[model samples]
Target: MMISEVSEKFDIPQDTLRYYERIGLIPHVNRNKSKIRDYTEEDCRWVEFVKCMRSAGLPIEVLIEYVGLFQQGDETVEARKELLIEQRTQLKARMEDMKKTLERLDYKIARYETGIAQTEKILRRPET
Candidate 1:
């Protein structure tokens, strides 16, 4: 498929896709006879993988390293797994932190609700 199709299909902007290719975030995409990008299935898979990793907050540097390892053939399999494991650990920690923050906000909101109810009750106590 063309670059525009890939961009639309992946819901990513064309410039971002170009940037990803330029930065080695995804492997170099093949160009057609006219020198335009022709995204193959493998290329699209890379795009999807990179997009998912990025959404999960994996750092660009880490991803670049992982992609580099990927290009180095089968000897780096364990190393890639280790990298993914490390990123997953970090993502889990971040999720835990976000969960705690949400709980705190909920607690604060409940307290405010209770306080407002009490105030309303006092105000309705017949003015004296």
Candidate 2:
């Protein structure tokens, strides 16, 4: 697949895909005879993995490190596992914090809804 096709399929901007390739956040993509990127299935899978990690709030440096480990072959399996575990732990903490914030917002909104209902009811009452 061409770079544009991959970008469109993944809903990622073309330039960002280029940047990921440039920074080693994802593996190098093969180029065509004319020097245009020709992404293979494996390359597209790499792009998908990188996009998933990025969506989970993984840092660029960490992804670059993970890709670097991946490129080093089987010896880095344990390292890769540790990296993913650490990132997962961090993601979990962030999710918890976001959950708390969401709960607070829900509470505040419900309070506002109740207050508005009361105000509307009072306004609709017949004057003494």
* Top candidate when judged by lDDT against the true structure: 1
What would the TM-scores of all predictions be?
0.90, 0.98
Clashes of 2: 0
In order of listing, the candidates' clash counts read 0, 0
lDDT of each: 0.96, 0.95
Each prediction's RMSD over C-alphas, in Å, is 1.5, 0.7
TM for candidate 2 is 0.98
- In model 2, which regions exceed 4 Å deviation? none
Which residue pairs show backbone clashes in model 1? none
